[model samples]
Target chain A: MRLIADLFLVVGAAFTLFGAIGLIRMPDVYNRIQAGTKAVTLGSLCLLIGIALLYPAWWSKLLVIGVLILITNPLGSSTIARALLKAGVKPWSKASVSQPGEADR
Target chain B: MTLTLLEIVALGLLGAAVLLSLLRLILGPTAPDRVVAADTLAVITTSGLVIIAALLGSPLYLDVALIYGTLAFVGVVAIARTIEGNG
Candidate 1:
C-alpha cells in the first residue's frame, strides 16, 4: 500500500510538472490553457487517489474532493477559453507562419 | 523530526511545478494567459495542500483543500467573466 501510494504521488507530480512546461512552451493562450487543464485535472485526481489509498479512513472525503475537481476543472478551463474567443482572441494560424516570406521577416 | 524520502521528493516536485506556473502568471503576455496561469496555480496549490495533509497525517487539511478548490473554480470563472467585460 505504501509503495503504491508513493508511486501515484510521483507520477502525479511528474504529470503536473510536464503540464507547467507545456504552459511555458505553448504558442498561444488557448494552447497553454489546454495544456494546463488536461495535466492539472488528471494530476490532482491521481494525488487524491493516492491519498485515499494511503489513508483508508479518508476515503469518503477524498471521493467528494475528487468528484468536485472532476467537475470544476474542465468547467473553468472551458469558460476561460470561451470568454477568450468571445473577446476576439484568435487561435494561432499556422498558414501565416508557414509562408516563407513571412517567416523570413 | 526528519522528513521522509517520499515527502521531500514529492514536495520538491510539486514546488517546482507551482513555481513554473507562477512564472507564467508573471510573464504571461495577455490577460487570458495570466488567467490561465492563475487557474493552474490554484489547482496545483490544492493538490500541494493534499500532499501536505498526507505528510502530516491531518484530515483537517483535506477540508481546507476542498474549500480552496471550490473557491478557485469560482475565482477562475469570475476572472473570465471580468475579462469578457460582463458584470
Candidate 2:
C-alpha cells in the first residue's frame, strides 16, 4: 500500500516537473500557460489520489480538495490567458510555430 | 514519523518542480506569464501538502491543503479580474 502511494506521488511530481520545464521552454506567455496548466492539474490529481490511498481516513477531505482543484485550476488558467489576450499579449507566431494565416498573408 | 525512501524521492521531485516554477515566476516575460506560473505553483503546493499529510500521518494537514486550494482559486480570480480591468 505504501509503495503504491509512493508510486503515485512520484509520478505526479514527475508530471509537475515536466510542466515546469515546458513553462520555461515554450515560447510566449500563452504557450507557457498552455504547458503549465494542464500538466500541473493532472499532477495534482494524482497526488491527491495517492494521499487518499495512503490515508483512507482522509478520503472524504481529499475528495473535496481534489474537486476544488479540478474546478479551479483550469478556470484560473483560462481566466489568466483571456486577460492576457485582452490586454494584447500576442501569441508566438510564424517565427516559432508557423501559422497558416501567416502563410496565406 | 521519519521519511521513507519513496517519500523522499517524491518530495525531491516535487521540490525540484516547485523550484522550476519559481524560476519562471521570477523570469517570466510578462504579467500574464508570471500569473500563470504563480497559478501553477499554487496548485502544486496543494499537491505537496497532500503528500506531506500522508508522510506525517495526520489528517489535519489535509484540511489545510483543502483550504489552501480554495483560497488559491480566489486569489487567481482576483488577480485576473484586476489585470483585466487595469492592464
Candidate 3:
C-alpha cells in the first residue's frame, strides 16, 4: 500500500512538471489551454489520490481536494479561453510559420 | 524494499502528463494561454502536494491540499472575470 502511495506521488509530480513544461513550450494560446486543461487536471487528480493513500486518516480531505480540482480546473481554463477569443486572439492558421510575402509588405 | 513495478509505472504516467502540460505552457503564444497554463499547473500542484503528504503519512498536508485547491479555483475565476471585464 505504501509503495502504491509512493508511486502515485512521484507520478503526479511528473505530470505537474510536464504541464509546466507545456506551459513553456506550446505554440499558441488555444493549444496551451487545451494541453493545460487535459494534462494538469488528470495529473493533479492522480497525485491527490496518491497522497490520500499515504495518509488514510485524511482520505476525506484528499477526496475533497480531488472533487474541487475536477470542478474548477477545466472551467477556469475554458473561461480564460473564452475571454481570449472575445479579445480577438485568433487561433493558429497552420502548425508552422512563414515570413510575410513582399506583396503584403 | 525496492520500488515495485506498479509504483514505477504510475510515476512514469504522471511524469508523462506533467511533460505534456509543460509543452503547452512553453509554447503558448498569448497572455490568456499562460494564464490557463498557470491555472492548470496550480491544480497539478495541489494534487501533488496531497500525494506527497499522503506518502509521508501526514494528514495535515491533506487539509492544506483541500484549502489550496479551493483557493486556486477562486483565483482562476477572479482572473477570468478581470480579463473579460477589461476586454
* Best by the lDDT measure: 1
Q: What TM-score, to 2 decimals, does candidate 1 have?
A: 0.90
Interface RMSD of 3: 3.7
Q: Residue-pair clashes per candidate, as listed?
A: 0, 0, 33
The CA lDDT at B27 in model 3 is 58
Q: List runs of model 2 lying over 4 Å from the truth.
A: A95-105
The number of residue pairs in model 3 that clash at the backbone is 33
Fnat of all models, as shown: 0.71, 0.80, 0.69
lDDT of 1 at A47: 84
Off by over 4 Å in 3: A95-105, B1-30
Which wins on lDDT, candidate 1 or candidate 3? Answer: 1
**Can you give the lDDT of residue A98 in candidate 1?**
58
Against the reference, the lDDT scores of all candidates come to: 0.85, 0.84, 0.68
Worst window of 10 by summed lDDT in candidate 3 chain A: A96-105
lDDT of 2 by residue, A39-100 (tens): 99888888888877777888888888888999998899889887776665667775456665
Better of 2 and 3 by TM-score: 2
List, for all models, the DockQ compared with the true complex. Answer: 0.66, 0.79, 0.43
Docking class of 1: medium
Residue A4, candidate 2: C-alpha displacement in angstroms: 1.5
